[model samples]
Target: MMRSGLLLFFIGLAACSPPVTKSKAKIEEFRQYLEKSRTDDGVLLESRMLAGSNGLVWENSGKYQGDILLDDSQLEDLVADFAGVSNDNNRNAFVVANTRWPNNVMIFNYASNEFNNAQQNAIRTAMSWIEHFSCVRFRWRSNERVFVRMTGNPTGCYAHVGFSTAHPNRVLNLARNNHCFSHGVIIHELLHSLGFQHMHQTYERDSFVRINWNNIISGQEFAFTRFPRNQVNLHGLPYEYTSIMHYHNQAFSRNRQPTIVPLRSFSGTMGQMEQTSYWDWLRLRRHYNCPGAWNRNSEEIMKKEVERTLPLIKLNLPAPKQGLFTDEDNAYVRALNADTNNEDIVNEEAMDYEDSDNENNNFNEDIGNDNYEN
Candidate 1:
């Protein structure tokens, strides 16, 4: 009986061991993967591809029109960031179905044959950097519609940036050599897709012009631009030197003469960094409703932002009372009343005079007739 009891206990222990060990191993593997893949403090890597099943269709309607080509590796980089996956296996599994999403991005690229290696790399880098903060996608076209002719038009008007209500595609001038290394231009154009207007009027203007957030940010525009106006509640973006979106060349000249500085010196001229700002990250995180990856102070800062924007939201909303009038309105009403009273008095006086005149005329006639009879 003792031997039989011991045998039963050993069989039960053996039955539980495999399942427990397997689950523990699986958890350990997952934990290791998380540690390696985590970026920006466990924030998932995020980005979308530019192409879709039907492929890119072109119409000769808008400015900065051209074909877009997407880089797969860059797309992978963005996915790694979105998934927060350090393990190669996990990332592959997540993105296997699709690299692009319906709402995330619209990629614009040219055919592989048309673009050289340098231009391709530049596009990839620019897209990757932008994807770090925003949930935008890419749209690559097979045929090249717009060509950048350096000799014919050195400024390359073909490479244009524009946004519209119907199809919001960011047009990149891939033909221009100037834009080849221009990450800032790429980001600036992308911001337009996200509903940001130009920071300064012309490229000739100084880059350091201060932005008044209250004056510029509107809910209507925000909705149109597809950016989270609520998330962009800060006064201004931080001055980041390393931000890829910063102006490439300083507008200031040592000779005290206005000159078009190269894109490389744009940030130095502006006295800001070439990298993305803290405000930029904040806006992206809020717009996407991303999980908490920002610093502990971020919560406090976001709370303040919410408070700061409450008044603006209220200002945009229609007032509850419909018939309420202001002091100016009251003054106008009083003036109109006074004018009406004056007109009434003048009419009354005119009527009284007419009656008196009629009575006088009859008396004059009677006196004249009696004199004649005498």
Candidate 2:
């Protein structure tokens, strides 16, 4: 009777196991992109993609910062390919899939128990910060094949950016040896999973800060490269230095010297992760189109915050290029432009944030661009 019971359990397991969705092998252009991307370490490894800027550094699959499971291409490379392609079908070859999670809901599971009790709690609290400010929600899995798999490994913490319906499910690893358990560190990794990039390397960053090549570690210089403009849609935001996503002033330092210095003389901490900055919440709210953003009663309060934020450093983008926008893109731009100048709206309002009680407020059109100030 015991043997029969065991046999029944085995059959049930087989019946419920989800089948992997079949996808074709990598495209030839992707192959070439990888070939062009070779580093001294050889082909860019599968996992250690930098959190953003198309990830310039290469690490073994065991290590990484990129959020996409597959490697991301530099904007220049993608733009070049786009210009050369006359065949409409080939256009799909370079298409950047929609990386946002479905319905602003993130489903996840644990793949490893390497996290100490504190580390586990760190992960939970980080998720709370996201929920505290935006409409996004995090849920544990229950027979959900499409979900994030949090793992505690010896390798550095890294995550595949965004949701992948085509190949759902991925690992978000935190190394035990690394300070991956810190509240800010854990929050940084989670933001990548939610589709954010390093604050410093976003496009049009030159106007805000200066990158000191002489101070960066020799081989790791590529880590400081800036992303191209127009690739990342800011949704009408301006550059910000206080964002939790910004890099530390001494990051990747070979001699403990500053690698990034602000162009203007502003005094404040840089690359901090203790908690999300005020603008961080605004960007999160705007990016996901958080349903109810600010209470109308708070409009005057928001205006004050806007006045305080407007004079800060910012990188203003030119109007969208003609012929570049899709129909949907065109519509989004039209409505957004119809509202007001990106910086003006950000400075004028957008301070109101939703609480757990589900406060209803108008989307303030507050804005901020990703920025680095380490």
Candidate 3:
């Protein structure tokens, strides 16, 4: 009787199989699951320290293409592509159309007290570098509904691809724990937050360089996948060998072999995080539709704008209590005290500079010209 019951149970299960429509849905789900597993399983949860050919260091930020953070909609689009599902409308026709900030202003804040004076200066300097060629402006966060909140957490220096109305309060983390405070890395993350994708992953990349599949870390080959034409618009820019967004030859190499080999003879390094190339600036200008941005002096305009709007921001009343200090806190306090003491010294130096000859005060003339071969 027990054997008969078991046999009937098996027969009943076979008879109750899902219908054709349900089977099709189940197959799609399975395919999506496989794609997700394939893409995410190989991602390094811990940050990997990487150096460019120019000796500039950076850390891989997130799961998507190493550092690019994708929202749910974006991830779905990517997974669809991985599963060989063609999608014409992956949210917006152009990624920039909906992602670009209004009035070309990037309202932001030092979200945490983790950023030291030097780190803050480096962040500002990187933004200043972008401002030199584009109309994009950065400002201290105010009551604006949308803005970039920059925090120095131990989360490995990742940022959202661009501004989204749905994902307002966009975060751009510069990981203090990972030493992701370099000028170039900060600029790179800033570019990501500004809606730029990796240059090497452009759709036309195969013509420019060859990918050595054997050298790429197993399962991490997804990182080398090209962005489809619908996803990225190049705005008629030529394929640049020295784009800062281009990966170094040895990037993601398992055996330290060249993963990205240039087809054409190039004098400059593929990845130099030291500075943004001219093409970088040009693309940014075209993205923002601000060709007239280069007319103004960025430094003076930013200084004047900050001075005008800073005092208007309302201060927090009934300020929060001070928290307990860790060992790191003690070091931070020391640095803060030293910085406070240097204020007067810096003021005095500025006064001295005012009285000096213009020719002798060319110290900062090359401040924004800090570019390598890239």
Candidate 4:
């Protein structure tokens, strides 16, 4: 009877699956949101995206291939003080400080006009889920000096990564659409606001995944970045492919080919928006130092929910450097995209003059992104 029940459950999970789209609209919309809302130039930075699906497969935000969310103002003083470590070698020297909200609380105020009743309820529901899983608490603002201004801009979705003592009036923008309303997508952006970086940007990500430079859209190579060993801290957790923080495997693809290829073999899903994966909740707990916030019973329930709701991730990754294309192939893709074929070329010449600390902090505003659904 138990075996039959499990089989039936698995079959049900596979019933509704979303196919991958070509562009990164969620990411682009985040950028558009920042641009249109007159966010600080410090928050407005370079961005890239491919077509996306209404399904919760791919999501993007500017800086480090749509991973980290906050701009310079939202970063810690350490980042602002370091300013610039100019070139690639210098870039390696800078590590944006790992930041989290003090006292494990994130205060927010939604612009009354940005969301309708349904959208507002959806946002609150996402907040409740985060509160349910970890020690992190979300509260409405009464007079907190530092708080997030949740806006309903028509452009895209974005959030300040972590607590910003430097900039108290931080923003998390989600447009009115199926894209921003999906619980998983809301959770993803909220994680960013909570200071969680993208999974692929982990310092050790190179060991777990291989990035195909040639397959990425030309001149948008900055969309994919591997953090230096000392820059990012994972709170002692291993890489998690299913974290809400993960970008889709096909993110930043240029010719409908995957830019990031995993190295392990797993017959389960990689990116799913159904809910927070086990590792995601664990990391959130670790970062906030929230001991015993999530109990074993909660874990068991969520684990089953994830397995029963998400598609099985069937990953047959190639060994590193095995059957993987190289930077040399980027030349062809650049030409195909009508982009400069030179891999050596750096897109941001202005970046060369700026300090490394400020480079990845700018953010994009959200624009209308049709590639999302419930």
Residue ranges of candidate 1 with Cα displaced over 4 Å: 1-102, 139-170, 200-273, 287-374
lDDT of 1 by residue, 9-75 (tens): 0000111111222354545553343333221222111110121111011111012111111123323
Question: Worst ten-residue run, lDDT, model 1?
Answer: 3-12
lDDT (10s digit) by residue, model 2, range 238-268: 5777666777776666576777888876556
**Total clashing pairs for each candidate:** 46, 13, 0, 40
Q: Cα RMSD (Å) between model 4 and the true structure?
A: 21.2
By lDDT, highest first, what's the ranking? 3, 4, 2, 1
Candidate 1, lDDT over the whole model: 0.29
Lowest-lDDT window of 10 residues in candidate 3? Answer: 4-13
Candidate 4 lDDT tens digits, 12-84: 0100113223245544543454343344333221221223421232244333234334454323221222222
Model 1: per-residue Cα lDDT at residue 148:
19
Predicted structure 4: lDDT = 0.50
What is the lDDT for 329 in model 4? 38
Q: TM-score: which is higher, 2 or 4?
A: 4
Per-residue error (Å), model 4, residue 262: 1.0
Residues 92-132, candidate 3, lDDT per residue (tens digit)? 34233467777778888874455654455557656755664
Reference-based TM-score, model 1: 0.33
Q: Rate the local accuracy (lDDT) of all candidates.
A: 0.29, 0.47, 0.53, 0.50
TM-score of each: 0.33, 0.57, 0.64, 0.61
